[model samples]
Target: MTETAPATATPGTPTDPGTGSIAGPSVAYQNWIDRQSRNRRQVQVGRALILIAFLALWEVAPRAGLVNPMLTSYPSAVWEGFLELLAQGNLGLHIGVTLLEVMISFAVAMILGTVVAICLWLSPMLEKILDPFLVVGNALPKIALVPIFYIWLGPQGSIYAVAIAVALFITILMLYTGFSQTDPNKIKLARTLGAGKRQILTKVVLPGNVHTFMATLKANVGLSLVGVIVGEFQASKAGLGYLIVYGSQIFRMDMVMAAIVILSLMSVAIYLAVQKAETWLIR
Candidate 1:
């Protein structure tokens, strides 16, 4: 009887018929994927444990006399204050006002910064003329401008003004720097193809610096929030910042902590929103 030779497997065909996986690479790849997933789970667990430990320590320290309860209000007191604020129907208003101011400031700064950066990129002479002034503006103490803005724009207007002022200059600087750093070779290639400045900017410069824009947005979000809070500390009638200031003045440590916790959560939400936007833009 003639013996038939075993059929040879083609490229990408499973070498081991029982396992149905590519020979060497399949095992290695699966191992890598498993390791990565395990690592991620471990990291998440570690973070959760750290947070729990911190909360437990915070809850224990004051009650155990390691820290003063009045000065460093515990988690329970802060939670009660938060619940009370929520029940009073003012928390929502404060959150809404602060969110509105922050969004307005963030939008205005981003729009203005983009416009200014584009103009600067278009005109080297204009950029040179404005460079010193830009530097001075960035270096100037923003806190010093708070009272001036209050005088010029009144209380509510000053909040927007301060928030914009805080984010705008830095946004301009970061964006302009990113714009200027576009590869000269790419620009020359575009020029060789008879592409105009506008085309080059839209097609090459902007696309190349998407990550830079994301970074700028991340920073601007925080700066805008800070500006709003600073303005509220001095001028506004209601906001988490006003809450903090009022609570501190009244020695309501629980209220102050509650406001701070809310602010922290707001910051996280804004940052995550920006990150989600970046992901969408990238895709």
Candidate 2:
């Protein structure tokens, strides 16, 4: 008799005819994972190349004396400056102050803006009345108002004012857009089902516009940071902006560059955090 292969089976398990084992992933699945890994690696390589190019230029121009080292400094000098700031703990303090301003302003703006948007959404008459005011506020140069804020609320007041200025218009615009763009068919369907206005807003409109709200939040993160930095430029005793001004005033180009780098890094960090939160919220 010819030898016969015994069919192997596991209780509660199925086998693939080609692989003989159920534990292995299909080729399509493996290909998808490989493609994703390759894409991730490419992104990483691209980021690394950009950073290396920036640093290389910073190192080359100064060392080659093509630029005035005192005026522009070198990448090494800025790195050393960063180390000094880290050792002294001033960097942390400065960053903390700016973060506090951003958080407070953002929170206040979001709450107030949402309330206003909701009220307007509920009452067309109120929206009509407030439209001009909103338009004028949005048109005004918020930076110019910093001086008035300093005078009225004192120097620290600029911090709150700037944050509000940055966040308010964006929040209002986004929320209004979200509320206005809600699907009319959904509204009609909800009404036909005997849903109240409040129910329509709470159960239908709000959820429908969650994605838009998340996008606005991401945009607000950048705006809030800009507001904080602008406030620092106007009147803060300490912040990344203050550090830049101080360094430049003293002709410490390396310190100025370091502070600029810190500000850029902070912005990136805030942006990334917002993006992560948006992803979670949307999912």
Candidate 3:
């Protein structure tokens, strides 16, 4: 009868004493996870500290007469202006109006642009015919057309028109490019399997371009907001943009700062929402 030797741990390979099971890799993995967690917490702390330092400097600079308070209101004054607006009960209304306009423009641009991109992709002749016109239109300074939109569509309609104009062209261009770039080998395989163009598009192309769609959505958020603000600057009676122009005209720098702060926060929230949606889609 032959005797069996007991399994032993080697260098870099720890073993459970009783069962002789390998445990080193699991411990190393746990250590890596801990390090990653620490790194993320440190990054978050660093960001908070930087923001605090900036706010402190801003608050101190004007008080010390390093800069004119009238021209550059501090954080406290902006907060006060925000409170005053809230008390006036119009702050909510302005925010709501701006948000509604942004959402409408975003939805319209995304839907219309995606359909246009698909149609262009489906017909190479149509794409070729429209290519030069699309390029020219996209290159045209959209800001130059603001007054024309206002004249043609009036105040509310002009807001939507301007917002869509800002976002639609880029969306179509990006989606068409992404669709055209779908792996040729995959398309060839689909065709060889007797798939029609529509099936190839729905099964292979659309699913593959989800990340592109998310990218377009993110870009459209900022562009649509910019267009709405620019339109409101010219044609709006009420909105954050209107408030900004009104405040500047009245030389109420604090009020202007407050509106700008709100706009920044709003944009951040919308961008974060889009990021979260992307994460969900990828999962």
Q: Cα lDDT of all candidates, in order?
A: 0.92, 0.85, 0.92
| Model 1, span 76-112: residue lDDT tens | 9999999999999999999999999999999999999
Assess the local accuracy of residue 36 in candidate 2 as a C-alpha lDDT between 0 and 100: 72
Residues 68-97 of candidate 2 have per-residue lDDT tens digits of: 899889889999999988998789988888
Give the candidate order by descending TM-score: 1, 3, 2
Q: Name model 3 segments beyond 4 Å from true.
A: 1-25
Candidate 3 on 1-283: residue-level lDDT in tens?
4333333345657677989876554555566667778879999999999999999999999999999998999999999999999999999999999999999999999999999999998999999999998888778878888899999999989999999999999999999999999999999999999999999999999999999999999999999999899999989999999999999999888899999999989989999999999999999
Worst 10 residues of 2 by lDDT: 1-10
Give each model a TM-score: 0.91, 0.87, 0.90
lDDT of 1 at 200: 99
The list of candidate 1 runs beyond 4 A from truth reads 1-25
The better candidate by TM-score, 2 or 3, is 3
